[model samples]
Target: MKVACTEKSQILGSKVAKTLGLPLVYSQFKAFPDGELYLKTGALDGETLLVSSTADNQSLVQLLLMIDACDRSEITLVLPYMGYARQDKRFNDGEPISSRAVARALSAGVSRVITINIHEPSVLSHFRAPAIDITLAPEMARWVASLGCDEPIILAPDKGAVIFASEIAKHGGWEYDHLSKTRLSGEEVRIAPSSVDAKGRDIVITDDIISTGGTLATAAGMLKDGGARSVHAACVHGVFASGGFARLAAAGLASIAASDTIESAASSYTAAGMIAEAMRE
Candidate 1:
């Protein structure tokens, strides 16, 4: 009945603690002047939940430590955001599958795993333990509705994001569609819908993760070009690396929001309630 979490995921840990009616463990961690980490926490059980996020490389290391410390009991790791999943495959002869490395590290520590909106689901097989993937569809829909956007239209950045966008639209009783993506280069791409009229729709563009904001910005640009009145962006994990959000806004995105998977500045949502509910089964 104990709960623990990494620093990047404190935002999610807070909500999960509230929903589960449990207290968060007293864990103290600090970084040395040279940037080394020091951590200490109270006693724990085998039946514990470790809430974590993929905000940075450190969070992953912290999670591994927490899992090892909880050897006295079984552990369930809840990662609101999963990084490295995009590198699930070795596209080149000398390329390393970072996603598999991450999964292996995590599996060695915890007994089971949980995550939301992984960029590549196949990465789950890299883990030695069982893993579950959750979505923020119901939660995202509720928030968009709360924003008072009447019958919103959920737009996917690309085909990969259609499943998430469709679920959001389904929950909100809205319509959804995926824009097309044409990669111009390894780092450059273009996006536009094949056929859709979005002249006056309140569009909410969504995806699994927002890494460099290239896909989203490109997609939003196309929607607006096609007469979309307004374009907002949402995602389960907002990496926003190298000023991705700034780029998205510069490309004319109305707003940028994400769940507190990483310690990003735009984490306007939490998945604790959703995760707790899903775990009840």
Candidate 2:
């Protein structure tokens, strides 16, 4: 199998290729004067692992183009971060199921698909081809353990993320719990954990995706108010959509860390090894 990666995931792709003892294929990408994307791939045959993180519309287009360029090759897409996954359901009339649409588009050119810590696992059902959802919680836990905090505790921003928190805690052998969240608005939320007694404990809030960071900010503030010694945040996909990193910093979080799914400054760990192992399976 050969490995090829979109520009956004070059760093991670190289790592995965090295682990699998596969050669990394080079692809050229550029943009026209009017901002249209152009992509060309080198020779690829047999089973090929195409690694890409659809962080935005442009990267999605790039992946599609690359898939089309790899003529007749069996393509297995590795989407470290599947964008538009949050819109998996129709909340109102006339709303589009964005995740399904994206899945269909992706399935059109790939034999199988793999994603890391998608917002909704149900979204994988939309793909016509076989789809796999991999978790980065173990990688996150390993990174957290490297921090070497005296009294580390893993916290989920809301009940929905309890499983993720628990996985990290289990891997790190730390205490784990979840917060109750009340969404006041798109950019506002109220988070609390009945009685964590966070006093003097170093807390790490873990989640699958951190978009606006509102939930993390609120939870971190609450922990600090409860006398927590320090609060940090970790996630698989750190979208940081609207100044989220700044918002978390303003909320007094000691640091923000995430997997290299989106290639941001907060990416303290790489999901390459995990993805490589999944591909082997």
* Candidate number of the best lDDT: 2
lDDT of 1 at 105: 81
Residue ranges of candidate 1 with Cα displaced over 4 Å: 181-191
- Model 2 TM-score, all chains together: 0.94
TM-score of 1: 0.91
**For candidate 2, what's the RMSD?**
2.7
lDDT by residue for model 2 over 1-281, one digit each (tens)?
Answer: 89999999998899899988999998889999999999888889888999999999999999889888876899999999998999999999999999999999989878999999889999999999999899998899888888879869888877778988998899867888888766789997556664576789999989998899986787788778878888999999989989999999999888899888999788899999899899878
Candidate 1, residues 1-281: lDDT per residue as tens digits? 78888877776787788899887887887888998777787789747888888667787778777777788878888878777788988899999999898888888757788878777888888888998788788878877777777677888877767888888888867888888766899997657654566777778888877879976787788778878878898888888888998999899987889887776679788788888987788
Q: Give the 10-residue window scoring lowest on summed lDDT in candidate 1.
A: 189-198
- How large is the C-alpha RMSD of every model relative to the true structure? 2.9, 2.7
* CA lDDT, candidate 1, residue 212: 94
